[model samples]
Target: MWVQRVIELTGWEPLGVSVDWAVVEGELGVPLPADYKELYEAFGGGVFSDSVYFLGRDEGVSFDFLAQWRVGLSVDQDGKFGDVSAVDPYAIYAPGGKGLVEWTPPNGPTSTSG
Candidate 1:
């Protein structure tokens, strides 16, 4: 429903892409949110309204979700991004721990995490 709303608002046709969730979750060391997975499946990777860039399963691309997540963690750990107060200091969400995870590209107004 939410994805449909996004489609309606953005006039984006769903790509209906398939992703290897097992591989993605395995690499991330945690299961991704169902809604996120659904969104990915519906839309894949691309920018929305030139503002929000949704990372997807595409490897080595600017919109690759997994690569962005790794880069986010690396940048946070290296203290390179600067002023990442929006995200937790160095925590990443896991089985019992709470932390932030990247779902969008970094820099500009396009990046986002949760």
Candidate 2:
């Protein structure tokens, strides 16, 4: 939760969070700069960008400035949780920037991953 708080205090908003932050791809996670945490909920973000199905570059994110689709995620300091499932544009205010999530009707929980 400390990680999430640090992100929010810095003014970044969380997009969504996966069940497990540890499960995020290593390559994609490794390249994130130190400031990445500052933009995460740990700083001040309210969104949850930790979902396994996050909608950003798989290789990495533009740490310098947030892209139109980039977002963050975090559990509150009290242990409460939040996600971006119902949020618009994930975190950005652009159109069609949420990418293409292939929903599989009402039967499968696993939607097609791009």
Candidate 3:
């Protein structure tokens, strides 16, 4: 409903392909909101309103959430922004730890745990 309204208002086009939610959730390790899923299903992944860019799922590509998360971890590991611990307060070292965790409701506040 809301997604349709927004799409109608913004004139955004659908991706014309169904997404594999199970794989996506497995990769992210979190359940995405229905609205977000709907939006992604409607628009795929691309820039919206000239400011927002939704991350799309692409096998073996760097556009998916896992890839983007890895990029962040890599940047932190390289200490490009100084000490990793100092830079990433909420980061959960997944190599031998509990792994990173992020929880968010539909357009609600987010909670993170390592």
Q: What is the per-residue lDDT of model 2 for residues 1-114, given as tens digits with 9 covering 90 to 100?
A: 555665467665654422222333242333333344333423323335664332332234532123323333322122343333424444534466755443332444433334
Please provide, for model 1 over 10-48, each residue's C-alpha lDDT reduced to its tens digit, 9 standing for 90 to 100: 997888888988888787656676778888888788887
Clashing pairs in 1: none
Model 2 clash number? 35
For candidate 3, write residues 1-114 as lDDT tens digits: 899998899887766547788877775566777788887788776665986668757564544766776677666774453434324455655556664554555555443445
Candidate 3 stretches greater than 4 Å from native: 59-62, 78-114
Evaluated at residue 80, the lDDT of candidate 2 is 42
Q: What is the lDDT of residue 1 in candidate 2?
A: 54
List all candidate RMSDs to the true structure. 10.2, 15.5, 9.0
Candidate No. with top lDDT: 1
Which candidate, 2 or 3, would have the higher lDDT against the true structure?
3
Worst 10 residues of 2 by lDDT: 69-78
For model 1, give the 10-residue run with minimal summed lDDT.
Answer: 103-112
Worst 10 residues of 3 by lDDT: 78-87
